[model samples]
Target: MILRTFGWSFAITALGLLAAFLYEGTTALGLVAVLAILEISLSFDNAVVNAKVLERMSAFWQRIFLTVGIAIAVFGMRLVFPLAIVAITANMSPFEALDLALNDQEKYAHALESAYPMIAAFGGMFLLMLFLDFVFEEHEYEWLAWLERPLARIGKLNQLSVVIAGGALAIAGGFFADDPGDVMIAGVLGMVTYILVNGLGDLFEGAGDVDEDSEDVKRGPNGLAVATGKAAFFLFLYLEVLDASFSFDGVIGAFAISTNLIIIALGLGIGAMYIRSLTVFLVRKGTLHEYVYLEHGAMWAIGALAFCMLVSIGHHVPEWITGGLGAGLIIAAFLSSVVRNRNEDGKNQSSADKELHSSGV
Candidate 1:
């Protein structure tokens, strides 16, 4: 099943390379493959994180994710969004931005590098909020009067947290503002955008029923169906957002290496394919749950991702070191989990053998 799902991704990736080579050349094709792998490696956690969301989704949305969703991620987020950012930040027309990106790779790269902090700040806040909400927010959504009261209290508090965070972010924006005026504006925009977008996500969530294991009541008549539908939709949305967030980094960084749109597309395309394939593979194999703290490792990776963005915005972190550190954290987490599991198995086996001997003649 894993192979079958990934097979198409592999094929399309190969075809993409073939097309790139035919049209662009060996260098373009090679760069695409490398970028694809880099993207996949960096995004392993994304897949695991996504699987947790995906498992809650209905089959229908999953189908959409594997199809239309990938295209949005590949073309829209990776290709278009970067150009859009370039255009907006540099005060150039979109075509002009594209021309600069393709023709003046060095200048384009410098522009992107300069903008890294702002993008990082935005992406980091958004992702951190997502992680927090998922980890701590009450998932129960029952509408009973007694249930609603306590739930309302918690919900209001969570909203308050958002307000507090927004305020804090606005303050930090002052610190990060290279130009006080521009920084203040970017910061405010970031805060307001985060509030509006996340609030809407929460509002839609209210229409659904309570999760089965959660204490909250189901709001809908067909609780299970509503929950499933909502979960699917949100899961799909989450994947798109996560893909876009990661793409911001790659798209920005890719300019540092090459300006050719085809080359950029090829490299990023290859990287994206690997990420998709690996995500599917990990999900099908249930690697996330099996690895115990791998998700924690991924969370740590997210933290690193946040730090990398912040550093990249102003400071230079060698790509090799940045990527290596994340890779190392994951490997260490895996090894620790393996050791812990082995110790657990030993204890269980001993208990079983003793029980059997004690029962026998």
Candidate 2:
């Protein structure tokens, strides 16, 4: 299963490394490798969260995510998006931005840095909304009952997530952001994007009662109704936006490692491929069903990341800190799931023994 799922990622990684070596010798090859590992570490939880969403998409849409979605993630977000940001913020044409990226990389990095507030504000708020909604929604299983139960109760209030997120945005803008107006606008847009995309997807998916017996209708691995047609399209949009949000920090942070855009793209692109493959692998293997708390952990990691992004506007938060926190949460959740499964197995064994004794077997 591992080979079947990750075979393409391995091929791409090898090819990408070879190309990097050919382009700029051993140093470039090493940097590309490091950047790729950095991306994977920072975004592993993203893969888990993505699996939760991807499982609900139909097979055709899932294929779209692996194929078309990958292109958008790799080239669109890793390469073009940064250039577009530089262009817009620096008040230059696209060609000029491209030249700046390829030639005057130091100046290009500075331009990208100038746009950091807006980037962080938008991505941070969007991620905060995702984490807020997840924790607030009632679920069958609770990893941290003391905290999640209370949050879930409060979540019953209409638009409470939005209210909380709005308050956070206001605080971030007023205190942390240099240009409060731009930060506020960008943050609001992020919130709105989440609402529109998530709301529309849910609206379309639940437009009518699902008929289990219908040929088109199917249950996902997690037992949710699979989204199809228009609903799937909206969901696809949500996924892309979510990916972009996750990419913001990585893209900006990569500048610290290498000003060369090509090396950054090659490395981050390779990591993106692995992430996509891992998402699909989880869905196909029904890993979420077995490790129920994994989603909870991933969401919490997202919340931590959101906080880091927002705080980073005023303070320099190390990438290792952000990556470590996320990795730790995911690992803890996986361990908790293992313990829960073992307990259940022991209980079943004890019950079987009792039954045998009672029946004089």
Candidate 3:
């Protein structure tokens, strides 16, 4: 199983490298490699969080994630979405925006750079809320109900939190966005996207069953149709939300590094493949539970990214700092996880040694 999954990942990575070569030769391939690694490093928490949602999905949806979902993430979010934004915000027709991007690269880059703050802000807010929801909210742990009790009560109050946060950001965004209408639309779309995706996840999860002793088993909804259908919806929804969140930093960062839209898409598009592969690897390996604080670290990264974006709206935040801070938090989490795993392994080994001594020696 490991070999097969690794093979798939390698194959996809090779394909992305090939695409980069075709588009812009070796330099583009090098850039794609860097971005791909950066994205993977930046999104370690994303893999952990996604596993929680995806474990509830059916086998069919999992396949879709590996196959069709990559296209949506790369082409739809990374390439087409930016073009669409340029068209809508710049008052050019879609075709015109495409023409400008392809023909008038300088102008297109200028227009996109102008809109970076808005995309960052929009994507940043959405991701921040998501991070908050996972980190601050109470989790449902059967064995830890005592601990979760208070958190569960607090979690119920999240609707108000969401409303206030979204409303305040919307108002603030009006001042920063180049196209207030477009920002508002995207904001609404993002929230609705979350609702729809999470709702579907609940539905599909309801339809499943598993052994009680299995720590891996996620509780599905109680009924058929509605539950499975809902799970499927949320599964797709979760990926989209995550895709949007990841896109914010990546898309804006791409503009900072290079203005060529084709190059931007090609580079980030290659990066997207690595993210998808990472998500799958996490799911198949049950790596989520192993990496204890990765989600917390990710949430921190999201919060930091959101704040940086807000500041960048009116002022400027250095890219090194923004990217550096995120990378640092994730690395810390990974190191913490390693130490924890080592400690647990030591304890288990000591126990086995004692048992063997008692039995015979």
- Who wins the lDDT comparison? 2
Query: Sorted on TM-score, highest at the top, how do the candidates line up?
Result: 2, 1, 3
Model 3 lDDT tens row, 1-361: 7555456567767887888789889987877777766666555556656665666565566667767887888788878888887897799998999999889977887887777766766666676567556544665322224533564566677475477558756765677666667556656665666566666565445443333333323333422221134446666767777777767666766666666676677667666666666666776766656776665566667767766775566566776677788778777877777787898899999999999999996
Q: How does model 1 fare in lDDT?
A: 0.64
Top of the candidates by TM-score: 2
Q: Between 2 and 3, whose lDDT is larger?
A: 2
How far does residue 314 in candidate 1 sit from its true spot (Å)? 2.1
Model 3 residue runs over 4 Å out of place are 1-3, 6-9, 22-24, 140-160, 167-189, 203-230, 342-361
Each candidate's root-mean-square deviation in Å? 6.8, 1.5, 5.3
TM-score computed on alpha carbons, candidate 2: 0.96
Q: What is the per-residue lDDT of model 1 for residues 1-361, given as tens digits with 9 covering 90 to 100?
A: 8667787687878888898789778877777777777766666667666665554445556567777887887788777777787798898899998898778877877777666667766775665555444433443322123543463456556455456445545554555446545544544554465556545444454544434443222323223332245544655666787776666667766666676776777777767766766666665576765776666566556657655654454456666665676677677778877877898899999999999999993
TM-score of each: 0.80, 0.96, 0.78
In model 2, the runs with Cα more than 4 Å from the true position are: 208-216, 219-224
lDDT of 2 by residue, 197-303 (tens): 88987776676236555444467655778877777888889999999999998998899999999999999999999999999999999989899899999999999
